[model samples]
Target: MTAGLSRRAAICGIGQTEFSKESGRTELQLACECVKSALDDAGLSPADVDGLVTFTMDTTEEIDVVRNLGIGELSMFSRVPYGGGAAAGTVLQAAMAVATGVADVVVCYRAFNERSGMRFGGFASTLTSMPLFLSWYGPYGLLTPASWVALHARRYMETYGVTNADFAPIAVVDRKHAATNPDAWFHGRPITVEDHQASRWIVEPVLRLLDCCQESDGGVAIVVTSTERARDLRQVPAVIEAAAQGATFDGESMTSYYRDDLTGLQEMGAVARRLWSMSGLSPDDIQTAFLYDHFTPFVLMQLEELGFCGRGEAKEFATVENLSIGGRLPINTNGGLLGEAYIHGMNGITEGVRQVRGTSHNQVDAVEHVLVTSGTGVPTSGLILGRD
Candidate 1:
């Protein structure tokens, strides 16, 4: 097993504002509210917080959040890149800082007004920086994220003999889980495979309307500190068993079209290898998972990449019986991004903490270890959280 930084830190607090289509509050306000709530949940004050971490895509600056929340004397602050892929990476940064004593009481947060303010699925007003790669695909109408992923999804179907009908189970299961979760936007509203098939096509033959995650406006924060200190805190410590970020050969933003295989996420596979090594635990050890579900096809790819099932077997494995509670592996108990609100994946980490703490609305029996992953098709990250 890989050594050095396993089980050094733990998440003692998780807090979030209500998920909504329109928060009616500034992103800064949403950020500060979650940060304060997380600190409160950890039985800590802003004065005790010494570090901060977030995504580079986040508009709320660290200094701005610190100043707004009255946090004093920041010792460490950092940001990860690649949009939603930075979710678990933020916690990795905080855990590393706390583990090495670079900082204590580190808080990782993500707050955005995605739905009501700026939608990721919407057209960009202007190009901030045009990389050379954009010249190849941008002119061909491969503009939005859905279109980018649809290109990969079509190739995956042809390579694996996977079909559009195969993706129905994923959507059905996610909404099934979300139906019981009151916090989910689709709470009490479950969809079937028929419902999935009836949904309008976003791209074509691959991505349907129900397959994409919601553009949500919300905020989520996690408090990380030493396990020793966390035991004395308000919540049960979800120990950081392992954490890692990975990018495979010839990786590009989401346009890694040059890879030998489009059916698998080699980047997440690299992350899986490190997590198991560092934590001294395999996929068998995990009782639950919060696999990033930004897109249904990517969820299947993650299942294969993370080794929960064999390559090209994710569709067969993504059954309602398999994904439900009391089944082999329960995923996205909080409804995932598709059913739940997307706080740029910070909410997924919060759900992982809930699993470890045995407090999920759809709580699995005796969940000692929970696996969480960030966005796929980019430089991504993953984490293993276990009971302390």
Candidate 2:
């Protein structure tokens, strides 16, 4: 079922810049700094990094980073498209390179001034470079990520009788975890369901302000290498038990309206199947999850898509006691795109690594396998990580 890349590559290091509205530096600096931080965490230097991967939306060029970090001739350099969806795909690219001997060590990074320079949530007058699927929605005034997601969110809510209230717990739990994470932008700031209900609607009847993730200015990076090489490095390695990327039939970016239904993320389901097949693990084996929480309703959809719950049952499965740290399946312990900084889901992967290392601030108990997912409503990707 797999190409035999599973567990051959492991994430050895993780690092990031402060989650903030303003970093006061160029995205290039943020990119270089985070890579250096990850390299430091892995006890490796720039020269040791022979491969690199990042998002197409990222402003920092590969050559600039390579030159700034003093990295030597690179064997592999890749750019995964699809904003938010490229998070785990970056790991997939790095892993494939490492597993096939194309490169020995690879660093995956993402950097942007989302809040200060280019806000992902802001209305785009003309995004010519956006995915072709997204252009379809612009004619209807779906000019922002929030507006685009609102279409599916409203459809899912209507199909299942789900309400705006059911999505509040996700935000509450994320902020609860962020309240304890010193590095989170919303650190020490936890909100309640009542607060979420009171928050003004971003897309009325579909999403509220609290339900939307912050547009953060930050950078995050991960180091991938052979399991053998990772074991000999600094931190405990988060073995890549499995990694997968999927784009479903008729799937479109943000607006997957052409599918059989709008209730579930078909692409995410495809990714879940491959992760299960490649890892030889079932949903019951996942001790924790680092789900992408760009929107709370999507978090619920991801839970169902990942097989954590039956379709339409996520409304009941996502409880305060359950999503919390000592619960059946704690998630987003480092805060998430919602409560932490939204570095296009790269921060979620970093938190997954911390969970595997058993060093997370809101660490779960005996985390054996951590499930990390990319964005929803798009060609998404996912990863299954475990202790080596």
Candidate 3:
């Protein structure tokens, strides 16, 4: 076991630009805005920042952000790859930096114009030209995310007898939470199981258009510092009880089709094992879950992989009041990527902080520990946020 770090890191500040399909702004501008907001929220200035972490996919680089934001010297700077999988990993990097005294204050951020500028869902031929690994799958008609995930979803249905209706409750519950959250992209728009069933199919027997997340253009950021120092910050510190990133054997980005198990998120399973072991908490201790909802089926799969339910039991768990607000475990009170803006899971981390602060728009009563996960069907990451 890699012994846990001694000093606990806590998120003392959170900030984000409005979640939307079209922000009409440059990615750099969005990054600066969010960085400034987070700094202000932390009751600190740009000069106080000594570390920075962001996604490798992010267009805004560290030097550019530092110069643009008028930030001073930085002691540590790094980036994680694999798009949405880097969400919690960015925070993990920041927290590690702060905990080790390599930096006093660190910020993790992600910003993009994914919708109006460059829609990721729209298939592009460039993927075929990228690398040999992607080339192998591109020629096989596994060109789109939905198509790649469909294969696994089909296998899951075949093995578990799960159906489209079984995935409906995930969307229904997230939309219900979104309906009450003014910041949510789907605010005031609650859906029923009928709505999920009625939505147009994106992939046969696997997903519908509504079952997938939106292409949002915005930015979200979080500030990390030692829990002791965070006590004097502006907001109630959301302690980082544990943070972990995991990639399972034979991991292949979003298209991990070669894995021995098609129905499980082994990468996420690895993250869950480390998170629970380090945090000394179990599924029963989680007050709410912010599992990645890039697709509804993946949400069910995550419930199973994270040990919230047994394998092939997530559909039953969802139907048996395990996923509702008043049920055993509420999930995605921020509406998730399905009903909320999808900033590649950055928004999910912000929601985890809100729950810890007891200020979430869809606040769960007496939230102590919240589990926030990154993108599934890939090398993913997770965080256990708790009250300090």
The C-alpha RMSD of each candidate to the native structure, in angstroms, is 1.5, 1.6, 1.6
Highest lDDT model number:
2
lDDT of 3 by residue, 1-388 (tens): 4336422899999989998888998999999999889889889888899899999899998888899878899999999888799999999999888878899999999999998877777746455364565586667767778777888788888889998888899888888889999999999999888888999988887898778888899999899999999998889999999899998788888778787778888889999998988898899999998999988888888999899989999988986266767789999989999888889999999999999999998888889999999988878899999998
Model 1 stretches with alpha carbons more than 4 Å out = 125-133
Worst 10 residues of 1 by lDDT: 122-131
Please write out the lDDT profile of model 2 over residues 1-388, one tens digit for every residue. 3649889999999988888998999999999999999999999999998999999889999999999999999999999988899999999999999999999999999999999997877737646566565567776777778887888888888988899999988999999999999989999999999999999988888899999999999999999999999999999999999999999788778877877688888889999999999999998999989899999999999889888899899999999888999887898998898888899999989999999999998888888999999988889899999999
Instruction: Give the TM-score of each candidate.
Output: 0.97, 0.97, 0.97
Give the lDDT ranking, best first.
2, 1, 3
lDDT of each: 0.90, 0.91, 0.88
Query: Which 10 consecutive positions of candidate 2 have the poorest summed lDDT?
Result: 123-132
Q: Against the correct fold, how does model 3 do in TM-score?
A: 0.97
Candidate 3 residue pairs in clash (backbone atoms < 3 Å): none
Q: What lDDT tens digits, residue by residue, belong to model 1 across residues 201-307?
A: 99898899999999999999999999999999889999999999988789888788888878777789999999989998999999989999888999888998898
In model 3, state the lDDT of residue 215. 87
